[model samples]
Target: MTYKEFMDSQTQLEAPAHLTPLLEALWYAGRDEWHRAHDIAQDNEHDPMHNWLHAFLHRQEGDFGNAAYWYRRANRTVYSGGLREEWQEMVRTQLPA
Candidate 1:
């Protein structure tokens, strides 16, 4: 789904059926369920998308150093600021509709 659409469609418990693992992670993260997001992201560590989402999850959990490590694994620069900002950037720049 489009990033905006995903943002809008928050009435459900599970991730959209068509979304990838990274998207699933993003969905759970947006709902403030870091553990759920982390579970999905951690399972697919070989993928850069997984690494990025995993990093974001760690960031949400207040683990900055671990987040930085995963960001490096994802080949992304470390980020700071509110979770919403990071989530929007990741959704817009990393995921597909």
Candidate 2:
């Protein structure tokens, strides 16, 4: 499903079916459940996207140092924007066609 669709469907009792692990984590993040989001994100490959999301999670939790490390892993410059904007940017970048 498209990202807009995903966002729109988020009011449901369940997450969308057959999402990638990252999308599932994003879904949980959308649900405002950070621990669940991190649980899924932690198991993902230690690649850029995972690192990026992990960084976002840590940053969300206000752990700047740990977030910096993960941001390094993701090769992304440290973000100085609001979390909601950053989250939407993540969704835009990672969103499926």
Clash totals in order: 0, 0
Estimate, for each residue in 8-56, the C-alpha lDDT of model 1 and write its tens digit. 7667866778877787788888898888888898899999878988888
- Ten-residue region with minimum lDDT total, candidate 1: 88-97
TM-score of each: 0.87, 0.92
How does residue 64 of candidate 2 score in lDDT? Answer: 96
Alpha-carbon shift of residue 38 in model 1 (angstroms): 0.2
Scored by lDDT, model 1 comes in at 0.83
Error of 2 at 51 (Å): 0.9
Misplaced by over 4 Å in model 1 are: 94-97
Q: For model 2, how many clashes?
A: 0
